[model samples]
Target: MNLVQLKMLDAIVRTQSLSKAANALHKSQPALTLAIKKLEAELGFELLDRNQYRLSLTEKGKLFHREAAQLLSAQSYLTQLANELALGNEANFKICYEQLCHAPQYNDIICDAFRQYQSTEFSVSSGKRFASLEQVNTAQADLGIGPWFDLFHATGDLESMPIGKLDIGIVCANNLVPKRVKYKQLQDYPCLAMFESEMSFDSERLSYSKGSAIMKIDDIATLKSFLISGAGWAMISLAHCQSELDSGLLQRVEVLDREHTFSAQIRVFRQYSVHHGPVARAIWQGFKRASEQFIND
Candidate 1:
């Protein structure tokens, strides 16, 4: 009859035993029995058959349980709407970034802003270029930070803010490899590619050279590992592999500029469904300021 009594019945049906339902709900067996009996008395019908060792819902009980579940769902939705209006996301603030985006700026924007909103949990993750964009579009992410490729600029119902720019560099590993290899010659070797964990959209095309053998990995760190092992080659931002390049563990492929390498526009974005919360807004501003200050360098 009442929501509380309905919830008690729902639990009883789920666990299939009054004692088990009491234990699950952390209420005394006497209290749960009285609540259910109280509802049955008001309805002029029995909701459960007491003869069975395990709780079994009567035909009337099954109908009431369906309605009870809908009520609970509505309550949850109302609570979420209230939280959104107040701009307090009790759930985790999730933002996905592509590896090519500047890390320092991301750190300052995310870590620093999250500290200010200590009550909320923060989740940081990386994905392939297009996946980051899709996360924002689908509202799985509060924001997506990554290089600005043509796919991003062309996306509808999404808003973007430029953070910085990075040159796409073709890199290979080890001292044994020559200073420069012809673009076409790379076709014989395995080419490392960054594949998105979620396959929503893809616009990745042949750049510099086409590889005959492609090995796709979803993570950048893993791709770097393959590159360092001399397993294959990949196009990554020079900044990400700078330390390895300096240590002689990796080298730029040194292909001619005419081969169509790209300079990427690093940026951040959010969807058009709703405005970002205060925490997300602060991080966006911080990212812009960091870009102007060259914090990425």
Candidate 2:
């Protein structure tokens, strides 16, 4: 049978119900049934037992299932290999930045280039402040933008470029808390802590022992929502949360330690590959210009 028929068989087997598989695949139950019946007829053997109520694969079905999965996995691997070969270092330029504040500016530059040259595609993801660098090392990401720290100093594997620095502050629902606060005073209230990837965390500095009552989260977008909902106060870049603060939707909690700034740097990195494709070179040039403007602004 074809890949579609095999996929349907596998989905039905894993889900244990034709109706559930049909719903998940966004196909009518009747269409799914016909596909299964067709597969069975072509094989000259029963693939499923309808009387059991639970979808159970027959002996032939089990044999085909294993083979089908192997085939699909091989196909997926081949596609990824082709994509990597074609795109090279420009396959994915990952950036770790404040979703609300930094993303807009980054998107503007990248999208503008896309509109003009239309030469590459981008996929963006978010992580805790520390994880961005790790993503670069793992080849899961090609670039990163986040708080500057000593991680790069130790590894001697990355190049950190300073972008525009933004002041970090506590954000809360308007009128929900005092306009200003002391660092120690923060222990009295719940704090929304955004955790970075495991590889990014510096066990010495990021542990809960520091002082605030923390509710940790890994997703950047979700963390913003919690602050907006007034569930808790969180540390965020002032540039990112300015609109909310100005609109009275969220209140800025000024902390006593004004000098305790988190310096943000956009670090562009790649493996020491001898060959960087045209797309990679073009994107890297764009990023360099973006960083220059980012720091200047």
Candidate 3:
């Protein structure tokens, strides 16, 4: 079947009405109906079920919709690649993050690697975590560095390599702690939390639990600012706070009777075709070498 027909089918399934789908695709309702009729006749299956103003996909249609999305994505990638080739050597790269990259040590190492490989010649910018990943999967980014969540593994063709791992900890102001602190004690005091879209571990969803009025912040900069100012204790990456920890600017507040540590893996995932580029190849090699030495040290 033609790509247009498949796209129409996906749109109908997504929008759930023939008129809505037609409006979305910018096509007349009758034309869309004809396309859908021809597709169903050719495939010999009922693709959609309509009831009044609503439409629902049949089992076969649902299966086809999934495959259609991937096919469309691949086609879009090919079109972008052609456009990039027309633009000559001004390559582009995107970096996405769940939180702002304020960790001086990690940032320096990444920037050093980019300079070592002359990656600075290319374009780089930060975006929201999932949007950044979508750019990478769509041939928009050469590399992505961010925190790992369960949904990250579901990207079909993107290969992920966890370059290094760092543990997350609670960052408390110096005056707040003379020694180790207890997790139970946090219940008695105000705490700050950074909220991302989907909470990964429901049973262990600590922030949502009843405690001393949790303050929800959307960005890392504000979260860190509040913590350093002693607004409240915050959960943060140890690697990000290492220098602060050593300098007495920030101290680790041990909770849960033990360290509540989660490993943050700096992963690099790329499309096989994109890896063929000179800049992409150099950055890959540099990150690999640096990650090895980082873990060992």
Candidate 4:
């Protein structure tokens, strides 16, 4: 009926002897026997066979003992979790990142940094630049690391900070886009882009060249697949495609009037309402450190 009685029963099952069980409980053998009888009476079942030479639980007693062990385990976990939360660990921490946030790099650095918040349940995922912000703002994520956009404004209580920048460039396979380029000239060929919004589309035209033949692909890796197959030329993060560019598989295309290499700022975002405890703040600092070391160059 109580934790004490339950634990006593557990000891009895483990020891399998009334004398041993009593020794463990620091009580007399008769006292232990009486307690077991009372417990069985309360449960309306014969928990042990009095006639058996060896101490053993009846079928029902075995089930009750299993449930008791589970209850004790649950209590222990709950107590540990409560203590951990009181000590400033997040009960559940969700972090969604932009696909280009260099997950492997963070894994090397932040994994050890997160050890301090041992009780904090942590999870990580990757998505588009906007999806990262959206996840943090909607309370789906405690934090987000994404490629920053100058025009994308994160309103409400969400706080965003620029951790670093991603170096990117307009690239074509085998220098096929042409050496002498104009914004208008690119309009003649298919341009791969990530976002589909009219403003983003307009920004694309205005930033690089005017174009309606632009294709929208949300994923950068997939876009690279298309570009490899000679689908079209598109602006992409140089950090991601450096190996291909180094091996002469792809080449950067520059406009006649503008520089070819450009960069997008990378930012970390979190909601003000999310509990930024000492551990969470420490985690964020660790992220900043990793970002700084992962320079575009």
Candidate 5:
């Protein structure tokens, strides 16, 4: 009938004794009994099996309690959110990251932030190319993590900190190309590229031979599939395809172009000269600390 009555039923179910539930809730046993009786009258069904030795829900009571539990959880969360907001925490924090930032330590950092800021809703999304930076710059995300290409540095409206480095190599399925091949020879095969039309920066450099037939694909998983099927060769992060490379499903081509093997500094960035709340500040600091640990390791 009401939260108080629903809570009483929940306590009774948990404690399995009306007296114990009354003691736990700091209410008189008679009042607890009366509340449940009223709730049953309103619901037109008994919520408990009074004849049970300890106490238990009736068949219908179990269904009702299941739904009531969700309401209680929402109430608790709302209370916590109110308290957190009173302390000046942000209501939401969004992070957009590239696949290269999916390292264990980075994931741990995000988890730690969540634990520390339970009331702050967290949104995380993975993007390709310059999408992360674009999200941060456009105020769509509170933070961004990805490769620190020259364009990212050139973005005057963003502030960035180097977190680590990503090793990328030009690779193809073993059957698609020779172990050692010239850059020009790669032109004959299609190049799988991850391109987002809204934010393509330095994308051309991702392919070793620009003359190669370009196959623009935004999804990394699909692109990897194409490479594995000898559909095309691509410049892929060593981290993303390490297992494949190890198992010989994919092979890194030895291209004459020394730059075929590329290394880019991974960075975490946010909009420049913008104020952030406690949750955002805590996450940012956590990231910086993680970056330091990463470098030392």
Candidate 6:
């Protein structure tokens, strides 16, 4: 009828006596007898044979006991799993990173975290521009690695630590633009910009030039494709296009404007919440250590 009743039945069948079962279970003999009686009455079948000298299970009792044992085992495992979760063992950990933050050190850190928490499922995804920040802020991801912008500082809900700096400059296909191109001259060619819902064409920052033929791209890979095809010039992270630059597939365009080249702090961030689990915390600490080593180097 219930776990208590099923347990009493189990103890009675095991000990072969109600008195002994009561003593083993720390319940009164009368209480054990009543529990069995109630269970038999509820099931419309006797679980114990009264005619036997030593108590033995009825034929139906054997089948019920077998199934009840499985339930007890499942209940035990469930209880243990709940306790583990309560202690901050995450079952699934998700991480979102921007394309610029795709470095070997970061991959190593994530692999280390996965090895440390082998039972936890780890998911890694690449996002464009501020996509990582949006994912972490909206609770779509547990952790995020991306370039830190001043706007992120204004969002008090996020806790971030700078991991390193990424150099971003205007780049285009070889021979696509003049070596010493003026800022205004860039408007003659199409300009590629990372697509953000709130992005404005009026801003001169980050490759957005006013009066230029603007091409909005959703991801870094596609933007690189366009750049390689000489579709346009864009502000891109040097780290992301290193191989291309090395092979002369892409070339950095020198701009007369001083702000053409700048360093952005790459950071790991998470939403401020008490619900962050042990695995997430470990990964965050790993990033912090990596950041320290990067700074020292």
1 versus 4: better lDDT goes to: 1
Candidate with more favorable, higher lDDT: 3 or 4:
4
TM-score of 1: 0.65
Report the number of clashing residue pairs per model. 0, 1, 1, 0, 0, 0
Which candidate leads in TM-score?
Answer: 3
- lDDT-better candidate, 3 vs 6: 6
Residue 177, candidate 6: Cα error in Å is: 0.9
lDDT, each prediction: 0.74, 0.66, 0.65, 0.72, 0.81, 0.81
Model 5 vs. true fold: TM: 0.66
Scored by Cα lDDT, where does model 2 land?
A: 0.66
Which segments of model 5 are wrong by more than 4 Å?
Answer: 1-87, 197-206
> Stretches of candidate 1 above 4 Å error?
1-81, 85-90, 196-211, 256-260, 291-297
Off by over 4 Å in 2: 1-101, 112-121, 207-212, 257-261, 267-274, 294-297
lDDT of 1 by residue, 1-297 (tens): 677887788788866888988997899999999999899999999989888877898988788777886786577557656786775654568888877775775676788878898878888777665667767765578788877766655564677777788887778887434556665666666778886443324545543336467788877788888899988778887788899999989987765424635687778777644645677677878877866765456
Residue-level lDDT of model 6, residues 1-297, one tens digit each, is: 788888888778767888989997999999899889998999999888889899998899889988986676567557646856775588788899887667888889899989999988898876556778767865568888988887775653788888888898899999999867788898798989876632222133644577889888878889999999999899889888999999999999887875688788889998764355678878988988987887887
Ranked by TM-score, the better of candidates 2 and 6 is 6
Scored by lDDT, model 6 comes in at: 0.81
For model 3, how does the per-residue alpha-carbon lDDT over 1-297 read when each residue is reduced to its tens digit?
A: 899998899788766778878997899999999999999999999788765457887888788778887887678667656755665432554555445333354455457656755523555555333444565654556666655555766653666655566577777788774346566666676788765442223223555224666777766667777888887777777766678789998887656575565666666566653424445565667667766776786
Q: Model 2, 34: alpha-carbon shift in Å? A: 50
Error of 3 at 241 (Å): 2.1
- TM-score, structure 6 vs. true: 0.66
- Write candidate 4's Cα lDDT for 92-209 as tens digits: 6788877765646656545775676677777887654466766775557878887777555634366666667778788878766785687777768887777632222234534354
- In model 6, the clashing pairs are none
Candidate 3: which stretches are off by over 4 Å? Answer: 1-5, 8-44, 48-57, 66-70, 98-142, 149-151, 177-182, 198-210, 256-259, 271-278, 291-297
Positional deviation of residue 204's Cα in model 2 after best superposition, in angstroms: 7.8
Q: Look at candidate 1 and tell me the lDDT of residue 146.
A: 79
If both were scored by TM-score, which would come out higher, candidate 1 or candidate 5?
A: 5
Q: Write out the backbone clash pairs for model 3.
A: 183-256
